[model samples]
Target: MKQEYEALFTPWKIGNLEIKNRIVLAPMGGTCIFGWMEPGGSHFDKEAARLLLKIAKHDCGLIIPGIAPVKDMLGGKWLYQNKRKFAELAEFMDELHATGAKMFVQMTAGFGRSFALTAPLAMLAKNKALNTLAKPYIDAEYLTAAPSVLPNRWADDVTTRAITEKEIKDIIYAFGETARLCKEAGVDGVEVHAVHEGYLLDQFTLKYTNKRTDDYGGSFENRYRFAAEIVKEIKDKCGDDFPVSLRYSVRSMTKAFQYGAMPGEDFEEIGRDMEESERAAKFLQDAGYDMLNCDNGTYDAWYWAHPPQYMPQNCNLEDVEHIKKFVDIPVVCAGKMEPDVGAKAVKEGGIDAMAVGRQFLADPKWVSKIKKGREEEIRPCICCHSACFNLTKHNGTANDQDLTESAGMCKCAVNPRSMQSKKYRVKPTDKPKRVAIIGGGVGGMEAARILALRGHEAEIYEKTSELGGVFIAAAAPEFKEKDKQLIAWQKHQLKKLGVKIHYNYEVKPDSLPSADEYIIATGAEANRIPIPGAADYAMDATDYLLGRKQVGKDVVIIGGGLTGCEIALDLFRKGKNPQIVEMKDDLIAVKNMCLANTSYLRDCFKTNKVPVYLNAGVAEITDKSVKVNLKDGRTVELPADDVIMSVGYHPIPLLQAAKNVHLLGDCKKVGNIRSAIWGAWDIAMKI
Candidate 1:
């Protein structure tokens, strides 16, 4: 290991529980032994256990699974009601200890208004009769309760009511019992699921979210009393020696209720600022919490808590380091933290430990890789929230993610076998054959790499001179460094696996290759609408992204989808005035787009004063101006120095007549990197 990284390998302590190293596998939803957000009885999640064990085997120092709710998501019973689950956890912990890793069960009070309200819950909330009938299984309204009445982040229509004092008391008692149960289960410690990310506990602590005259609201002490009581109660039940950590936010960085202050942007903090965080940090320690797993941002500023590639690396470090001075307890900083940066911070006593999240999903063996001085082999997490935690809101609907995607949270976009190990693991093929992949894009490359790993001779034929098809353009944005790195990693892996590459060579239907199997990953073509003067006045998204074309200062972008929004934001960042026109009610109208990602872009647009015209359509384009049909039935003429079209794409597959031919990626259908890569893995494994 590098000398700077040596600090991360050193032992650390939270109260009396000594961790093997300063590396903490930060909690993530669906990674807990207890079922997460699933409408089922609290029990040992074998799948979660399997995954956690795999990570543990990779030499992780400390493992904190996803925050397990005190109250069941489905059943009316509290977490303590499931006694058998504790026994199972004890057994899992015993084996986990054998791998030299200490485990902490992160227990949450609840999501409150922060709950990603799905379609079924929305139905239950609207239909009172159905809600009452479903009470034994799921309390829709109760599940959606907040510290005070507030607009739901997922949807404006559903405002969550205030959580009653009685309910708060019940949860406090539950935390105590939950800690006791965790101790009985031989877990190393318990971490409070948080006064962070604007969850139930955080809602009470933040003045903007909590508004009441009761003991749990109004004053700073009152606002924090709920969380304070939880740790105190846990200590009373589990003893002071029993370690208790708190998931904390060093800075909320919220400028408004649903607006985030982007990194390095000077703005008034609407939520908890640094001064308050300093006091709160000391106060939380005084309240009996042993450690602070720190980060910045709330649900309003979701990107900070769950940063995309756009956010800065070690984004929360400086703030977390500043907060560390206020408390003596170990402070771990999360949020796009770099290993070397974290090591330097730890070595200099800026922070005690490094808490990482999605990187573990991308590569569970990352810790082991670093330990073996094979850091380059560690698969990088691009921080795309596609397969994991796709809490999307669209068309005035809360939680627009599909039911299956919603159930399966904390997945990785690049690693298809992350959560589905049993189903997707590579096996030795009895028969090896030559495979032809007709595209050097991410999907085609992924297919080729996996096929080669499975003992097949895989060769990629690229029509272009380089690998990474549309992904090259997708990674063109300056903020997309991680995406570019991912492409580099894939290329490195393909070369390492000795996969043959045929560049600048396109295979046609008439010119057939003598391979056992063929995969067409020709990707997609930009969809063009029949608007007047489109050919003359507009630049396709692909052409612009590929740097083949440039736009003028005043740009009117057509479409408000992810691609269009991204283009607009990219252009705006580059000192171009880009206006968006969309027929949708919201910015990102598509489902399964994570709130963490979309919220950042939306907040960025708002913060930077980028003009967005929703519920509008482009009528026509001219040399001097672009005509837009506004929702109010007014035909407004926007200055048309340039027009960028990013409506969407259509599949373009080739060589489909071959007997063993297959299709994947955008060529199969318009989808994301998760779908494309996973599709490649699924088909490659079958062959």
Candidate 2:
């Protein structure tokens, strides 16, 4: 019987170029630092080129870069500053073109978040010349324009200056120059990234930010003029032969904002009410856009934009159909789009093409796996946002969890060798070694699974009753239940590879069996913070959220990292007034991994009036009250019936005694679950 997905596997074409299949690798940011610039621009690293070529050979018809900065001198908000010569970029472009896959570059203006990073870099350089007091002015000045004028809900009371007319002109010119460069680089096309609630484009589009009374503000047509002119300029520079794709979302994941400031009560409302979105699409298409990539949500409201499993897969296919009816040009749909779901969308004629993001991260050989009908073998994107989203947000670097540290290299979560496909194949080793893995946490489980797959007799000794380590903490949050699936999948894979697992067997380093080598996966320990009344009132958020213990009515949580935020949410779910106090100005530094959801969670907390005090320190703790030092250097007292300590966790250093031992997961370094698992996999593969 012919499969419904065969249509998706069939040959297709865009403009004069021909392609093999309908599956397209949506232009996604490959690395974190190049927020608005292509890695090909300045990061002319060999590994980046190799990664791109490997992705091209994966049977995907069209492959789009996450983004490429379209600037001349490279001075934009969050955009990447390219110092490398144009010749280097041209060489990378030639290699991608030779891979038999159509290539496009995603382009966007800088978002306010970019300033949060660039501000500090500039401040550091200035501080070396000046002093500490002068540093604040530089930081404040950058923030004033990047986020303050833009009005970000995530930013901590930072002020920004409104962009002047001269700055706007420079931006338009930058976009034009970038397009010209992309054309010179010999790329197939450029996708205008006016979505994902990132950069200058989305910031201008969201009405909540554009309150200025000028040509760039007021009505929908006026707000979209800058983008329209930029798209027009690109078309004029690249010519009609080069296909230009425009990626936009009708809803802002942030809450009330959407592309061009549209609002969506539900999915259907987003499509129906956003006349400006359709108008902008028509304007760009009329101006010469060949394709439209539609998705839902913005960054301010984040969760809706990068919709996870909590929302249905292919959640915005209907939005694509709505726009498809209005425009004659091809429509591309993205947002948690699965293989079968994408195939069905194409088969049913709901959309012309399918754009995938996290799926490619989960399995880069996604198109190849689908072409061969090995759907089950394709590792699905669990959407933990650890690798892609988190890294992009905080550090501005691509998640190299599974790949080597070489710059511009693309990596995956499940398959460590996905980006390094050319370097290593799933072939049996020359000589199989008997491996002993202690502790069934992420690191141990990963090592055991990979070693067994390499034809090694791998035996895992779990000290506790379960295999998962801090991954269990993922399920402790109100919206992180999906993480449990990933942990279960890892366990299932380990068992399928014929790994020997022994639970509740505590083995010290000396008591362990002798093998070729040993892997110590003994995870991390919780940091115990000293306070006056800690013993009676303080409990680790992990312990409280995991249902190991109950929290009190008026609870205060110290530390505002990802762990603390989740604990607060768990307390909120329990109908408690959660007060989170952090020494830092911002709540969580690792927010990129869980963008939209974080916005939603923050809003929920604020709406419920849950107190969140920043730049506050706990001066004293007692049974009846807790004293805090405010940013103004004043002390305030609040009742602390209960307290949760989320200060931070430390590695369990007892593993140092074991000879030829390796550490993985939070035990070695405090990081996401992907890091621990991938760390284990890498070490085991070499062993």
Candidate 3:
């Protein structure tokens, strides 16, 4: 192991329990061992269990599987009532213990107003009779009940009614009963999922969300009584030695409803502040919580908790370190934590452990790689919540995500076999054959790698000298360092796998190479909109990103999609003034994009004073200015030294159809990295 990471390998203790190392597998949403959002009664989710066990076997010290709701979403049965699942878990625990890893089941009180409401769920919430009929199957009302009546995070029409005191008491009792079952099942401990992330229990703690005069809300102690009582109940049911970790938010970086404060932005916090967090940290610790697994932000400021690439490394470290001073119990910092930074923090006693979540989904063997001093071989998580946890919401859409993705969270965009082992496994082919993959983008490279792994001779043919295709331009920004790393990782994997590459050789459909099968990954071309003088005055998004075109101080971006907004932010950071014009009502109003990723860019633009023109279209581009048509039917000329068009892309395949020929990636359908990689895997496995 490297010298810097030595501290991370050292032993750490959470209460009386000793963990072999300081790396903790943080809980995500859908990796729950007891199942999540399913229609039937709670049962042991073997898929999730298999994923967690793999991580444990790979040398993770402490494994905390995703949030297991104390009450089942369907049928609303208490978790303790599912005794069969506990028995299964007990047997699984014995197997996990053989790997020398401790296990903690994260139990959630529920998602109160923070419940991500879908369109159907919003309808069920608004119509009383519909909700009554759906109660047995979904219980949308019970799922969304909060400390006080508040608008749902994802839906404007859906309101979460104030939860009754009886429900609160029932939930507290459920925590005790569940903890007891976990203890009897031979589980090491249980982590409350939490008085954090603006969930049901967290709603009771925040003054803005909790307006009740009942015993659960009012003074600081009253506001925190819900959390304090949970730990106390767990201690009473299980022994005091049974370690309980609290998934804590050191500070809530929220500004208003559905708005978040950008990192380092000056704003008055509407959620929990630092002063209250310090006191609450000590209070919750004194109330029998053995450890504090800490981060920041609520559902309103979701980016701080579920940070994307734009967030700085160790984004939650400073606050977590500060909170550690207030509590004697062990502290684990999560949220984009770098391994080296975490090691330094652990060595200096800044934090006891480093909690990592999404990275494990990207590479389950990351810990083993680190210990073996082969960190470069480990795949890096680019933090694109494209496939995993992409519960999207915008100005007018409610949870605009595919229902399949909503149910199956924690699947990595880069690694297909993380949560989906059965679907995307590497098996030896019965017959090995030479395969040719056109284009050297991520999709083509992934196909070649998988084909080679399955005992096939695969080669890539690229038109350019480099391998990453348009992704090279996409990773040009400083904030997108992880994207660049991904490109490098793919190149390295292809080289190590001995996949032959023919660069600077573009193959025409008539001049195809001799191969048993062919994969067409020619990618897409940028859409050029017809506008007066645009052909002469405007450049494509890739031109600016690739440094082929330069923009002056006053720049106008023709689209407010993810690419345009990112370009605007990149320009602004580089000391250039950039303005955005979009026909949509909101920026990045696309489906399958996580709110955490989009909210960060939106908040950054707002904080940096980047001018945005929404519901507007660019009519024409002049040499020094661009004419825009506003939503109010007014034409305005904006000062623009240069114009960059980011209207989107269209696939341009070299070969449409042929026997033994398949298309993948943007050439087949223009989607994100998840689609490209998964599509490649599906085709590669078949071949």
Candidate 4:
């Protein structure tokens, strides 16, 4: 093992509890042992529990499940009312302890105004008749309360009223009751979820969000009183010796209400600054919290809390380290944290531990790989947030994900068997058969791996020298280092599984390979616009990414979907001026797109002073200039040293009617990694 990672395995104390290692699995939505953000009765989620148990068996030291909402998001039943479920939790904890992992139940007051309200729920809140009719089952206003009457982070059409003083006390009581129940249920401790992420508790802490004259809102102490009181009540109920960690954001990192400060941007903070964080860290510690599970961000600065590939590694490390000085409690930082860099941070005593989230979703055996000196074998989290926290937004909708999908959050984009252990798992196939998968993209590789694991001969036919289809271009950007790592990991896995690889071999539709099954994964081609002189003047998006074409200083990229936006960002980073012309109202305004990734890209364009024309289209392409129709009614000619086409793609399934032939990845339909990978897994398991 690396000397730097030694600190990670060292024992650490949280109050009276002795944790065997400094590694922590930070909480994420839908992976909660006690049910995720589901809209129903609060109970033990066996699916989520099974996922955590697998992680525990992988040798994790401390595992914190996702938020156990103090007030149920669905039926408004207080969590304490579900006391019967605590018995199941006790038994689950017993099993976790056998693996030498201490579990912490993360209890939350609520999302309040920061809640990712879907369109249907927003409509329900707007209509008095509908709200009254749905009152027994759901209450939109109660679920979306605020510290003060404020504009909701999700919808501009709706405003959330201030949470009543009586309601605050009730929630505090709920916290104490929940903590007491957790201790009795054999849990090691409880972590408050949090005066962070600009949630209900956090709204009270931030001056901009809290404009109340009540005892719980004015001044620093009053603003903090709600959280402090919750801590005191929990300690009183669970015993003062019982450990309690606070999930804290060291700095809000917001430029203003509904705005975020870009990383390294020296903007005046409109939310909690570092100076206030230092004082608050001490105050929270003094109030009897044992440790600080820290990061940086608010709902406004979503990227910092839920970082994407665009954000740098260990983005919140400096701010967290600074906060550690003001308090004696152990501090852990989590924000796109790299294992090696985080281990270095731990070794230097900058932070006590590293709290990893999405990586655990990608690979449960991540820590075991590190401990066994097999760091290269660990699957990297690309931080796409496509399957995990994909709370999408676009024109005419606050959130695009359906309610059912919203409930089953935190599924991995790359790893299909994350929370879906019940559905997708490798149980040795009764009938082993030869499988030939065309194309070497992510989906093809995934299908090959699964088939190989199931005692089948799986062979991949790649036209290029290497695997990774369109994903090769996707991972080419400097910011996509992890995506590159993921590609390498996939290739390594395929080789280890003994899957046959025939490089530079493209199977033709006419001469199909002799196999039990054929999987078509020949990815889509970039759609070129049909403008005049486009063939001579405009370059394909994939060609530009593969470095086949070099554009001059000024580049205009057509299409503002995720691909085009990412390409534009790459172009800008490489000392080139890039302008984006999109037919959509916003960049990457499509479903299943995580807000964290999209917001970071959006912020980058604004921060770097890049030009983006939305709801616009290209009219014609010239040698050194291009004509465009703006969102309004104006048509203008803009200088374009080069034009990259990224409009969209069409499926290119080679043998759609062939017997026993399956279509996967882009060849079937142009979709993101999730659809491709999951689609491959779904078919592979059946065959």
Top candidate when judged by lDDT against the true structure = 3
What is the alpha-carbon lDDT for the whole of candidate 3?
0.92
Ranking by TM-score: 3, 4, 1, 2
Task: Put down candidate 2 lDDT per residue, 1-687, tens digits, no spaces.
Answer: 128677677676566666667877776555321332333233444544555566678877787766554431123232224535446667776767676787777776545533333334334423445424544333334333441264433333333567677767776677667777767767677777764444566666556666667887777766676677777777677777877777777544443432212223333322223576666667667767788878876554455556644455677777777777777787878877766677887888788888887677676776776677765455667766655554323222221122222232346655566444555455577888887787887678878877877788889888778878667866656556446666776777876777888889888756877677778777777898776677776777777767787756888888877678777877776788778888887566443355444444456566567788888988788876778899998998877777888988888844763456777677678776677767877677677
Best by TM-score: 3
Give the lowest summed-lDDT range of ten residues in model 2: 397-406
Candidate models: Cα lDDT each: 0.88, 0.64, 0.92, 0.88
Residues 593-639, candidate 1: write the lDDT tens digits: 98889988888888888888889888889998889888899999988
* TM-score, one value per model: 0.97, 0.75, 0.99, 0.98
lDDT of 3 by residue, 516-544 (tens): 99999999999989999899999999999
Q: In candidate 4, which residue ranges exceed 4 Å CA deviation?
A: 36-39, 657-659
Model 4 per-residue lDDT tens digits across residues 257-375 = 56788888989887899999989999999998999999989988999999988888899999999988888889989988877888888888899999999999999999998889998
TM-score of 1: 0.97
Q: Per model, how many backbone clashes are there?
A: 0, 30, 0, 0
